[model samples]
Target: MSLRTFKMVIAIVIGGFLIAGIYISVLVVERQGALRQISLYNPAWEAGQAASEFIRLEQRLSELGRPGSTVDRNEVELRYDILVGRAQILTEGRFQGLLERNPEHGATLRELQDRLAAIQPLVGELDRNPAAARQALDILRPLEGKLAQLASAAHNHGAALVQKDQQELVRLHWLFSGIAVSLILIGVVLILLLDRHNRLLTRAHQELHVLAHQDALTGLPNRVVLRERLEQGLAGLRAKGPSLAVAYLDLDHFKDVNDSFGHETGDELLKAVAERLRDCIPVDEGHTKNLISRFGGDEFAILQTGIRRPEESAALAARIVEALRAPFSVNGQEIFIGTSIGIALAQGGVTSSQILKHADMALYHAKADGRGTFRFFEPAMDEQLHARRLLEADLRKAMANGEFELHYQPQINLKANEITGFETLLRWHHPERGPIPPSEFIPVAEDTGLLSTLGEWILEQACREAAGWPRNIHVAVNLSPVQFRSRGLVQSVSRALAVSGLAPERLELEITESVLLQDNEATLSMLHQLRRLGVRIAMDDFGTGYSSLSYLRSFPFDKIKIDQSFVREMSQRADCAAIVQSVASLGANLGMPTVAEGIETEDQLRRIEAAGCTDAQGYYFGRPRPARDLVHTLAALRQPTEVA
Candidate 1:
């Protein structure tokens, strides 16, 4: 049956038991009253007491009748009162009822009462004259035998009443016993039902608690439970010496992995990583020495307690990083991912949020140092992070206030010795901080989701500026990786060309291998689409990234920009010169022009030019200048050749 119905039945049973108990109690009370009345009725003792008192009173009346005897009127009067009291007792209580049961006994009691009433008046007369007391005794003497017979009958009748009361009490006892048994059985069932309900309630509570605290995919503690655990641990160490450390860990290039693979693979990879992290720590019981949690995405946290020293924390962080170094096999393929950890130890008084913030700052610093490493917390990290946040806020507003401008660096042809193109570079002139380098603001732009907007603005402005330049001079603008991946890239490029009325042949888009690393197939497809638009595509920082040669075979790039690292060192290092020569030869054989970037000295330019470099651009040409200033420099350079 349903629980509600069962409860109703139990209630009804209990109510019935209550009613039965009440009925039993009332019956028991009634029986006890009958039993009490029967117990008090000792008909033989009362009748004998009345008869003995009458004989004693008769003896006293005879003494008063003795002639010349010492007259004792007081004794005679006391005996008369005693006899009257006893006679009244025989007529009262159960005795009268017992005597009525037998007609002979009842008639005998009535005749005795009439005889006593006749003697009372004579006794009162004898009290006034002692000689009259004998007359009262003579009247009661004949009825004494009738009174004795009545007493015997009363005694027999009382015995029957007592027997009847005992039988009723016995019946009540059996009925009460049955009711008590039913109540016991009901109580046992109710107790069992209540116990079962309590157990189910406990289990449901445990399940809800698990859902609240655990990560759905990884089965690790989520951020909410992690914070609660940290708070509890910190509270314990507050009064004592704090020997605790908090580590904030994040996977390097996780986004790249997610983009390259699928989200399903990413989720499986996270679960695998969580399991490895647990294995890396010491676990005596089910719980580890450290509480690990998936903070969010590829980010995780480890809350460590009972630390002996700060070095212990650093060692733990190192171990965690090395533990993740081993490749994880996901979907039957080996996927390598690195972990960067930031360690923050308790110093003085540290709250959970502050400790977490410090660890985050240290993690950012670790990334700044380079990924796949760990760093200890320091106060200066907060200051640097705060400055970065301020810069990011201002950078957001810079474009709106027109604080950004394009500087053109001339890319001069080695053979023609005239400016063929100018590479468009972005510069931010903050009103308060002065000029911010692209190195500083470009990463910030990418991180703040401002790259796409900044990229479109750069495209439009560069095209507009280059349109105003000499027709033979082309314009090259660097493209952020985010922009290339965006679906709006083709549309943005088309719009820029349309609005500026710049020839597509004179527009060059520079892309780094970072874009190629994200999704090669998609990146190649996008590059081909852009190539079909009739603009030139140059691979920027060509030799710095993986498979630089393989990428050239994947797409017929218009130009290969030799990385400045190889170009700047070519004059000093033979290896650098050999790399420069090989890249220049490769570009020539592929029917692509090679541009050696960052050429500052005559010797470096000569080395690249000897290596058959077709185009070069660096400080040796000229520093990037404003469009108006570039006109003067180009006019001076073209004085003799005049647009080649």
Candidate 2:
């Protein structure tokens, strides 16, 4: 039963109990009042009976006082005394009992007691003289009148009590009837409300069940519901020998979408993608099914049964990718999202999980091959996925294990041939994988969100190591695009400077053009924040990306490093020399220091120095080395130079 139904039933039961209590209370009050009235009237009824008996005895005594009658005075006196004593006893017992129970009747009972006491004296007087019998008769006659009046009052009082008791009975019946009617009305109302509430509860429960099985954002079947559907598809494939295909779809660059736009727009884009995927798959003829579900954030899966061939599944996957390639307009921006689809065919006793894994592997390949594409699963993909997973796991533990180290490449003053600073390069020495190059692991770290921690570690280590170096040379560290986009990048830099006791003016953060391609405001804001910290900002790999001049004008960078590609071809190509010379002249005009990278020979260094480049770094000066090796090299360079 639903919670609402249970509550409704409890409410109805409580209402019934309340009505019953009210009815019982009313009955008890009426019954108690009737009992009190009966107690009051009983005394009056007993007094009336005693008074009538006294009148009858007095009349007998008057008849026996005639001259013709022989009278026994002692017997008459004894009988009269007996009558008076009986009357006294009855008056004191029953009337006093009534007065005790009903104090409101105390005055009437006392008056009756006084009258009975007067009758006792009169009876004693009659017993004393038979001649006084006539006088007594006369007194007894008026006494009889008074006794009759008392009897009449007693009868009236008894009648009044009976009338009161009848009224009380009527009131009790009315009260009980009203309570019964109220209880019936309440029961009916409760039953009606409970029935309505139960219906509403049932509807709500059904809706909740539907919602539970569905994705709240996209209205697609959720992971749990999709898993059940996939299992059923697998069962059918196993029993009927039909081919089933599962495709895992992942949105490429979805994080960029969420980062550039807000999450609300990202959610809208996901819902739009889900609708497109659902529309792409046609329903099967009869028993076979095509089911679409949202696996998780920007990840979706589809299960298609009764495929005659693997190529059909590939076609379906392609259609899903093509559908997602359409631009989604959300929040007044035309957002383009690409999807990579992975297809796995059901055969060779593939379980649900294995099929899903194969599809995911294909998706990974699709994404790696460039998004907006699809790939069919191959067995060897499992090896690549395993290796990737292992690499990710090791990367997570690399920082804590102290397996990472920095190498410094000295930047030189091209004209003076003096070392200006060193660029810090990160390297990981894995125990099992030997030395892992930055090219291989840096991208992985960026993709896996390990770059933030790795970047901070390198910064802190470089700052600390540079603090111990000679005061003339500055230390430069490369900031990955991931780290630059991090929320704590500025704070991390500030903390590194404070902790290492390294002056901010001596530290330079090298950032690529990709970091500036995001929100220009945020990027500029972060750049301005770092600039305010008194650290030199160098545009690394300059002229390699679009908007080289625009970037220079947007933010005031202290230095611009000419990419090695342009520097390497300066000896062979005149165009490379002209480009370097133009960039150097532009830097000089803008008051920004220009450094040419990858200067190998004295001739190339002279050419760059003649081009007005202030700084240069390459093998010509010194190769990247560890801190100890760089220290020895710095010490050697500080000695007197020997001209060859």
Candidate 3:
């Protein structure tokens, strides 16, 4: 109940008590007055009866004394006795106290006594003579008139007192009734107020619940609420075989928006996007169930239910992408954002965590392909992701346990058939798996963010291994794009060179095209820092990416290694040979030496040399081998070589 209601109820109860108190007081006062009046009336009536009886006794005596009449003494005595009894009866009972208390009733009792004394004298005179009796009778008549007048006055006064008491009693009754009515009205008012208060409290509670579950910015369900809903949907799906779909949506380039504009603008853009998503989902009572939620930051999740097939989820994913493709207006600025959606559907044997993981894996694939796309979950994708996770765990242990080893494949100067350098490769020897290939684990290391440690270790190991080799032979180690983008890349390389006691001129770092495609300032700064430290930078796998001639001119590179794909295709495709030749000519013009990789035959080696490639590395020269074997190969290169 509300305060108003409580107050009103209290007021009504108090009013009732007040009215009851007044009525009780009135009843007590009125009853007391009536009792007093009745007491006075009884006394006055007794006095009048006594006086009338005395007058009657004297008259009877006078009648007996009349001429020639005989008086009966016994009859007169009996009549007097009866009159006394009547007077006693009038004075006795409940009203006797009023006669004793009232001065007027006391005086009236004395007057009655005086009148009876005078009547006694009259009775004696009547007994003596007839004339005397007649005179006594006449006097008795006047006394009787005076007594009647006094009795009538007393009776009238008693009647007036009784009337006054009756009036007070009636007024008391009305007052009590009025009080009761007022109390009833107050009670009614109190009930209404209490009811209103209760409703208000109920509404406030509901509003509080809504606010707790909803996002303050977008008025959509928040992450906590969304997770709860997802769990409930998943539980239902577990019981009955209904397909449940979850799409993890991330706004592409959201960081760019934050970098370009302020966070305020980014927030506005997110709210707008949330509204668009809410509007895009269809509401159907029968077929489809959809709920959009803000999953914090620029990420959102959509729970789609009742999907019959995987393609339906894919279609929903596409629709989400389309919905977010439109530009949003934030603070008068037009901001465009694309979305990458990862969708996972619940089949029979999937937990919520596994489903979310699959969705994240699909999200990874979507981002890998490009932004503004959506992908469905695949079981093999989950296996691959799990493998990467396992590799990351093992990589951490590998660094601690010294399980990483370096192998070098010699890159030969094809024209002289002389060893120029060895390309460093890292191999992981897992205690359980024995040997994990670089092709399978390198990408995993990069994705798992273990490349920073792994890359530096390889650099140090390779530089130390090459320090013992001939002075002309250099060591080349591959750098992942993730490692190249790291802020500590230059410092790490400088430290490795220092620790190994290897000439920085002989320590070559091989980077792929992906590294050059990163942020210009950071990548360029890193490259320049490496050059300043006397470390050679080579562009590896040149033909596979957006490798332009302009990059060669813009950035100083020591060499350009043709990708193995083009090198292997040279014998079958004339275009491959011509492209390789063109790249080598371009490298020569730019003063950057060219290295052809994957040279398997003399024909491929001849084509590379004819194309003016300076260095070659493939199975034809030597496959990647341990340092001991590579040292022997290097020592054999020191001997005079026979031309092919």
Candidate 4:
């Protein structure tokens, strides 16, 4: 039965038991009440008491009848009153009902009452006349035999009533005993049912536990099982001489397969991958000492034990990678996919969780170095990961702590020899570590999803600060590629302009070619939307990507900022100078001004200017400074000083 049905059955059984118990209790209460009513007045006892009282009264009257017998009148009166009281008791209440049931007993009691009533008048006169006692004695003497007979009949009736009650009590006792036995039998049946239910529950729990630990699609052990084996393997390594390794593998570009073909093909491919992974292990050591587990969604883990050398684990990883490189036929279609593996070898102090994390870190680096390869976890990777986490944590709190500041680097117009605008650069001054470079924290912000909030703040702050600047100069803020992929990029830019009351034309948004690399159409559409908002768009870090020129042709940017790397080496490298001249010429032909960045020295500045660059931004102009320091810095820059 289903669990709900089983529960309902148990509930019904318990309710039946409760009802039966209550019924039995009610039976017991009714039986006790009947017995109590029967016990309230014993017919035999009443009859016997009446007979005794009469005999005493008779004997007292006989004494008074004897000549010169000294009997206290009060004693005689008390005996008389007691006899009358007993007779009255027999004729009233429960006794009266019993007397009515037996007509002989009722008639005898009435006759005795009539005789006592007749002697009562003589007994009262006995105090005044001695002869009255004899008369009273004569009347009471005949009542003795009648009262004895009445008592004997009452005794017989009481015996019959008691025997009937005893028989009924015997029947009730048997009934109760049967009920008790039935209850015990019901309890046994309930216990057996409960035992059966418990067994079913236990079996179901075991099945559920297996399902919890096993991957449904691959039917292989999942991460939970992998972690368990890793713990066991690590324990064995600590106690024994051989070491173990955990390799975390992630399918590279698996999402493309799902998108291109379908998820069904992807699932079949994963199942096929699972089979190949099993084959990749040595036939003798399959799943006994080493375990392979799926970590869900294009990720899997392998635990290798009894390793004498690191090369052994490396060989296994290589075998798996090589095995997966061959295309698999899924749904009659040839599909090619590769895996990236990160291996972490067991050590004295390394735990299962830490080793797993280390492997994941290695996998990240492997993917970074280009996928379809494997890497070992190194100490430096752990250190760098730890530092990045610390920086991310600090970056989250930096906004609320008011530690973020906007620094604007003046973009110099080479033709006018005057300042054109400033590029809004974000700077973070950690309370303890001092200023953290944007290169260090920016990626952390992107990874932690703090970039949206940070990006919005940057846009607003840059616009607000630039709004206070001289109207002719504009402020340029570089947008992260992640910000473009995320929603609300357009809304954030619009809000920053609106909230700061800055003209959209004065706000220049810069993006690199990387933004267009992921979603080319979407990025261009976003650029168009930003352009419609009356803002100037620029391509920052120009000439960094192979498709930078094509991206410029796709969108009409107001300005192009030549990458600092090219400008820095333009003086030393002929190719760098030619590229700079070419980008400047290209920008001029497009009617877009090209700003040469990293112009530190006069010779580099002269080369870019000679190359027909429109604007230059670097140390040769001024270092990026806070908005508050810009006015004084600008005035100082306008005053020419002799070169040292």
Candidate 5:
């Protein structure tokens, strides 16, 4: 019940009790009044005492009438006085009312008073005159029956009053009994109401506790409960013989799911994943020591307790990985997803936070290695993660400090044997570490969500620098997958071209196949928007991804750059050469320029040019140089080649 309703019931119960008590008090007071009236004045007892006194006085007078009697005159006078008092009592107060109500009783009372008055003087002179005693007896003897009749009448009236009083007493008794019953019923109702209120409070408290410690979406233990369980397990690790394993599980590409589908569908998919995770562990019989919790979003944590070895945790992780591999049907769509797990074994001297951190680091490595896999936490991973965090922190500062610069690598047209354009490459120079390789800091920038900002800076800077170059040469800039995910990507590109006053056709934006892997419609739409800007688009690092050929069909491109790995091994590996030639032939047929990257020698260049490659960009032609040196490099490249 609501608090207001509960309070109202209590108020009603108290009011009932108060009303019952008040009525009971009134009944008790009335009963007491009736009892006091009946006990204080009893007409039947008064009449009997008066009659006995009359008899005693008569006998004493008879003794005085005898010759030489032993009866004392003073005693006879005392009897006379006592009889007078009794007659007075019978005619007063309640008795008077009783007698006056009956004509016969009233007349008898008058006659008795007259008789007593007439014998008052005769009693004292009884010893002196025997005739006086004889006269008294004659006067009193006629009134005996009258006195008896008066007594009988008083007795009948008293009996009637007692009967009426008895009825009133019975009524009072029933009234008191009824009030008592009412009080008991009220007490019962109050008890029942109070019990129900308590039960409601208890249920509300339980629900609050659940809401505090349980995940609302998945109904799993939340992070708060997870931390508690992990702490408890860690504390008992030394006392118990078995080991503890904390596994950090993250749904791979879960953000993509949320983006592609709606958040509601993503929520359903998370619930399904939680169910699958629960099914993967053994929790029946005596195996109740394990705990699985949702750490919010697409992240979950599992605690395996009382395990014999690390292998058990590994097996559990493997089971979870396998269980999640199956397609989940959410909102009538079969969505295929995967998980990356990181496991940390608990030992002496390790805190819960440390273990969880280690597990998270391992999870990062799992995702880095590729999703749908698991990895055990290693000491080396901690160092690596620490370094990565430091790098990410420094990367942010580097962007603000203007410590990065760009170099231009020339893309050669084999037919013209001249420089066509320079690919814009980013180079970072940290204050403390000097030059940091792109391989090391690029992933950190992407993971740290700084790539979009950095990519914008690169695009504007490259366009600004290329605007000063010869009007015939264009500039190519590489686009990270992270940049395409940004809603402002097309705007950033347009802003760059507008600010630099560079020709749209002279700005080439290069992207890898990974950019098309996310939100196909959005990606294609963004690509079309960029295409409408009159800028050239090239597929960079072509043939590096599984869906590169499909991506080529998905979007038309101005050029295709053959990945360096294939070009590097083309001479040694015939298949590599054949694959490069096939891509070149395909590009030619589609009227798209194909640039072979990483060409270092004449033999590699000759092979690519003869195999229908239109362009080449490698160290053999020119290494990437800064814009200051690029002017001279371009001037040197424009020089005609001398025949041997």
Candidate 6:
């Protein structure tokens, strides 16, 4: 039962006990009254007494029979009156109720009444003649038997009533016992429940404490604990302790691991890395002065105290790097990952925020310097870091400010001996900086999450620009890997095609092999979706990625653009020539065109044509040009008859 219901039951039990006690008490009082009244009302006692009194009246009559007895006639009348009055009491009230249940008691009472009536005449005559009273005494003798029977019946009925009363009292005793037992059991159950609740509360409080400080996956201290410890170290430095070192560490290419394997394996790898970090902190003679914590994802933090020199922190950083240098075996696969550590040493009353910022800046420098290394915080790094942040912020506003423009580079079809398509290249012309190289801002755009916006703008603008071009010529636009990850990528392409009034067949989306790296299934699905719209899809920079062959087999392509690196070296290197030849033949067999990129010299172009490359693009064709420049270039490159 519920607690409320149990309490109600307990109340009912107690109330029942109280009521039963009251009823038993009242019954006991009535039983006692019954016992006392039995002396007067019981036919047994009264009948015996009346018989003795009648016998005495007979003697009194005998005295009247003798000469000069002197027993008054009024005294004889009083004796008869006493015997009859006791008999009348049995016929009334409680005695009457008891006798009604038993017919023998009533019958005996009636017999005695008849005998008393018969004697009444004899006793009355005694007052008339004293000598006649002797004969009246004889009439009373026969009444003894009837009086005895009345006494016996009264005794049995009274005993029976008393026995019934005793049974009722016993029943009340059992009921009170049952209620008391139930109440005790309820109290015991309540106590047990309360104890269990208290234990659960205590355990939950302890778990909450652990959750506050510890990481669920790694069992290491989390960001909250790291912050507290870092602040404590800063406070210690202010109070005349050794200079402290706050190090920020991040795993390099951790996302690649997650994309390659599932998240479960990734989580196991994180735990493994956490264990290594914990083990990397060395035990010192004068008590350990390091606190390692997870700063979320693949980033971790360390607060190192008692650092006498910069070399100590460097050595610690090296240890962390070396420890993680070995490949971690997760899910039966060996995966190699690197750590970039940035240690910011105490600099004259350094606060926690300052150290955290400096350490993070230093980490960025370490990653920029090529990961798997550590960098210490330098005074001048702040200026460069601030500039990077400002540049990223400006790049975000580039799309809104209309600073982005697309330049087209011609794709030469060696077999047709004419320009087939112009690959759309994005160029950002800053209002203040004049012009910025795409290499400089593209990474920033990607890192700042502006790639999606810039990519969409490039798609729509390229389609719009390509709309007015000769219908025979197709426009090729590079789609970033980040853009393909968007759920609305196919819709965005459709909208661009719809708005620009460009035919899907005239717009070609160029995707590098890197786009297929993260999720092959999703990438293939998106490729199929674009193809369904009647648009052409080409795997650009084909041999650049590790799994170029696998990606080729995974999805059929409209065209394969060989990476420029192989094309630039194809004349000098036989392996490069063979690779280009093999790729061209492979594309022919697959019924897809092969486009060789970075063909600058005539010898390179002639050699690629001999090697069966159907199309080529590089500085030889022309550098990427603006739409105005491309309009004249396209008119000049068209067939002589069309030009006339």
Q: Which candidate is the best by lDDT?
A: 5
Against the unseen true structure, what C-alpha lDDT does each candidate score? 0.82, 0.79, 0.76, 0.85, 0.86, 0.80
- What C-alpha lDDT, on a 0 to 100 scale, does residue 409 get in candidate 3? 82
The TM-score between candidate 5 and the true structure equals 0.56
State candidate 4's TM-score. 0.46
Using lDDT as the measure, what is the rank order of every candidate, best first? 5, 4, 1, 6, 2, 3
After best superposition, candidate 2 residue 408: deviation in angstroms?
A: 0.2
lDDT tens digits, residue span 155-230, model 1: 6666767787788878877777877787788788778867876776788799899889988888888999878978
Query: Quick one: RMSD of model 1?
Result: 30.1
Q: Give per-residue CA lDDT, model 5, range 1-644, as digits (tens).
A: 68998898899899989989999999989999889868734678889778877887788877874678788778888888998999888777778677667778788888899999998788778768768877788878888887877777777877888888889999999989988998998999989998899999999999999999999999999989988988887777765477778899999888988999999999999999988877877563133367889998899998887875455677788888989988999999999999999988875688988998989999998999989999988874465467777888899899789999999888888888778999999999999999998967887787678888999999999999999998989999999889988889899999999999999999999988888888888998999999999999999989877698788888999999999999989889999999999999999899999999999899999989888899999988777788887752434754555111
Name the better of 3 and 4 by lDDT.
Answer: 4
Off by over 4 Å in 4: 1-340, 343-385, 632-635, 638-644
Q: What's the C-alpha lDDT at position 366 in model 5?
A: 93
TM-score of decoy 1: 0.46
Shift of residue 642 alpha carbon in model 2, Å: 14
Task: Summarize candidate 3's per-residue lDDT along 1-644 as a digit string, tens digits.
Answer: 56676677667767776876777687677667756665555655765676678677675666664477566545555555666575556446744554555566545545545544455554455435456545544544545654565566657766776787778767767766776677677678767766777888889898998888888888888778767877787788745455778888999989999999999998888888987887777654236788888877888888888865455566678888998888888898888889999888776667778787887888888888899999878774365457667877887798899898887788988667678889987888999999988766776676677888888878888888899988988999888778876788888988998998999999888888778888867888889989999989999988776755657767889999999899999889999999899999988888988999999899898888888898899878666778876643445634445221
Best-performing candidate as measured by TM-score: 5
| Candidate 6 structure quality by residue, lDDT tens digits, 548-581 | 8888888888999988888889878999999899
Count the clashes in each prediction.
Answer: 0, 0, 0, 0, 0, 1
> Candidate 3: lDDT over CA atoms?
0.76
* Residue pairs with clashing backbones, model 6: 44-151
Residue 391 error for model 4, in Å?
2.3
